[model samples]
Target: MLNTSRRLWNQFFRKARKVNNEPLNKVSLIVLIVVDIFILINVVMGLDDISRWYISPSQAEPCYSQWQNYRTKTTTDKDFEIIKNSFFGIDNPLSQEQIYQQVEERHLGKVSQTCFQYAKYQEQINIPPNQQIIQNIEQKQIQVSQFEQSNSNIRAQYDSTLLEKIAGQSREKSINVVGAEKAKQELDQNNQRISTLKQEITNLKNQLVTKPESMNFLGFLQEDSNFNQVEVNYQQASFWYPSIQLGFQSLFLVPLILVALSIHNFAQRREYGLIALISWHLLVIFFLPLILKIFEFLQVGVLFRFTFDILSTLLGGLLFLISYVYILLIPIVGFGIIQLCQKVILNTKAQAVRRIQDSRCIQCAKKIRTHDTYCPHCGYYQYIECPNCHNLTYKYLSHCHQCGAFQESSHNHA
Candidate 1:
């Protein structure tokens, strides 16, 4: 059974992996983490062996023995005949196929009952179940089969296909009877509805021909005040309705924009192009994070959350496309894209340079790349003395790296 289950899982997983054509990523990682959590709960429920197919022979012995006893008793013994007909209700010896199925079900039940009994009232058994119990069960099962072989004159047999055909015909006749009754009822109901609707249709046709002559009927050409009220009610409901209720539910562009802008910003920052670096971060990192949080918060309810997720997934895709285009055009926002890159640099040295070495424009963090040394981000720069180590650095640096100290060094140095 374990082997069978493994084959099933392998077949399923192989198909999934083939369709993707690539290994899993962070999203898949996140999903698997969530799956693992549910699997842990299932493991606790003690259904693990159903998946693994590892039922012990000791557990199978009693079920196998009962199956053999019933198999032989059905052919020659009247008492066995009653038990077999009552349980399976088929006048046939138990087939190999039926035995296998019964064994599987019985073992599963035994495992579940055993686990439940152990948990419901604690008892400890240290040693493993021995082969003697399993062998005894197998011997009893063999005896019934041997007895049937020895008494072929009394033991009558019918092929499974013929037996199934007879059983199926009976079932089919019963189903046809039920279906006929249902169809007759439906036909009567539909006939009644058709008569009623025909009367209404005739009335409507007469009104269409005669109503235009009435002056009061001119109101039909104008707005119906009742319909206006319905329209207003619809508008009110639209705000709270799930995206399906709102026609353009597929086009949730906000989250898409954030994720796209973030990816773009990340790439631009890596390339050191300044525009996309800033734009990407401002839109995605700073904005997208805040947006997801707000969306999750607002959609705390299940129906609302599912609707929100669908809309958000759609919008997020479009936003990503836009972000990619923008990141190509403007490089600064690339700061936001760093999180996507497999390799992340702490860049303490570069960060130190950004903080202390280069002058940053007050309005932004753009580095002053040229000697004129005006702050590039905001174009705000001023020359300041390094009180410590006497090595001039950006005032924003706060601590002097030269002296390994917080304040500028008071002592003069070249």
Candidate 2:
């Protein structure tokens, strides 16, 4: 097995290093290596592009900003508290349906308002007015921020004074429930005042919206059937972008690798396992593309869409079945392929042809004289004594040339 492997390796190198009878120059080999390197780099770049698309934080920035602007008009502190609790609190956390409902009630209204505002502004909004409106919004935000800072400081001082009074009562061994109740009332009043301030801030922010921009185009698209179809197409592309990129990358990369390997190993097909080589190449070239296309088909949600509709409504479930089927079928198919290579595909005909070219080295396919017992090019033993005529004959050939008699040896059959 080791000797066979070594011989195969030698054959591979011999083909890689030469074309016809001439050795490939160092420059040509270097060029081939560089091309392979470039292919590797291209694959890496494709991966980067896919990752960038998937994790694009900026894609929703405009939507988020518009959502925030809308929230100033619609959302209150109570709504904010509910959202924060749903996210972090351990007790009575929101169910998926409840969370979605809350989001729809609060945010969907804003989304609608935003779209309506955009439609209204589209007719009248100009560059100068838009700039002035944006400036006004920024100034209102600054004022709200200053007020919030001042409110925070006042709240902190009131809380500290209440804590100190409670500690003092504890030290005196006389629990002042009246004093404690008054302190609680003051805290409540302070909270009410802060809430009033926040409401006033929201009103100021709402006044600054002189013009509105179209940000939720995706959401706005759902209102019309034509626009809804466009949304579906966009969603499909967005969903499949990564998988399609991967498939495309593999589509090019795998072929390049196959070509490189073909140049290095199958240059002299007749001299090697020609049948096995050809069959393997066909399998690789066929199956790899098919697999990639299957992945692309899956990623685009086409099965969820209408192409698979005629076949079955539950295409997604069918795909899961197909995935398991592939898992089982692949090994069986692989075993069959291995058997084909070992038994039927890699037959002795190729070796017989090589033996017919008996004047050449069996290992390297370099020309040799009939009298030479071993190949000068590859050091492969090429000649042996014929038992019938006691004369030198080709070792790999079936019939002895000296007497035209059959060579009864296991090596000859092989």
Candidate 3:
């Protein structure tokens, strides 16, 4: 069994080495390798793009982090300030009362907008009552938006009028008294309009909360049902995303590998060197990404998550110890694999057996006569006396060829 396995490995290496037998073929192989690397990079990138089609946790629930902070009672005034500034793009420093008001307003607006979206999503899936609730929220939101826009316009006009009034007063000694008086009247009217708009906007916002359907939607957001479901779905999608990407990448490469393998096998049978070389390159290109993605999946997919959960549960505060454990364990594991390969898989005895079977010196692999006891090239012993048969047999072979007696020393060496 070992001899058969060794023969297959030797044949594979022999064919691979033959692929670049000539100088021109070597250059062609290098060019094909460069092409393969380029294709592999692009294939990996394409897989990444496909994986992003699923919604991420942050995208699915934009306010989740803030909501969590709020729920945990860890939201400080600094957090509210940051949120308020971000929402309104505020650059100027605000007074304490102004900061509080702006933060409260921003929070309400965000909640309302999120709830409206949730309602719309539910309505799209034909959920009863959500359609009516969505329509009501949309109407109220539009009204609030329009009022806010008008209020901004009115404030801009009031500021202009007030500035004009101050200029007119400054020029009162040189200009007409009538123009100064008119500027003052315009400023007063603008101020009154600004006050009225502020009242109207406040009234509209209050009315938005008063509506039954809108109130219910707001209540839903407050209760965390909508956000919780989205969070759960986002987590589930994230957990499976790596596996999905690996599956898709495999699907893409598997067919190419199969085709290339078939071509390679056919070419080898027919002694079509060039065809076999190209097919071998194609097979390697197709398999490289698959092997890389499998490793990637093992690191980041559900398997990793499961392993992480177990470690977290077991180690708790001692989780950092895992790094030290891996640092010590990996070298030991690698050393064991190396020892196994040296002792059993690719041992020197296995190579000697193949060389002996081909009538070559076991030490130098140079041509030798069947009855030669020592290699002429290397002066290494080619045969040893088998105790059971008292006959010379090839060194490193498990059994004596003449008497079919087991060579104990040869078996030990193997």
By TM-score, the best candidate is: 3
Q: Estimate the TM-score of every prediction.
A: 0.21, 0.44, 0.49
lDDT of every model, 2 decimals = 0.38, 0.48, 0.59
What are the runs in model 1 whose C-alpha is more than 4 Å off?
1-367, 370-373, 382-391, 407-414
Residue 390 miss distance in model 1 (angstroms): 6.3
Per-residue accuracy of model 2 over 1-414 as CA lDDT, tens digit each: 355446556654554455554565798767755754565456556545534433222131213333333344444443322222222222435533344345445431222233233333332332344445445544655665665675566565656556757676452553333344555565566566667665665554443331133223223422354233334444555555555555555565566556645553454444443333333344344345445544555434434244334435555557556555446655675577656754565434366456446566655555678667677765777667888888877665668888988887724422
**Per-residue error at 122 for model 3, in Å?**
7.3
lDDT, candidate 1, at 276: 43
All models, RMSD in angstroms: 28.5, 13.1, 12.8
Q: Write the per-residue lDDT of candidate 3 for residues 35-115, one digit (tens) a residue.
A: 778877876777676555444444444555655654566433332222222222223455333443444454321223452
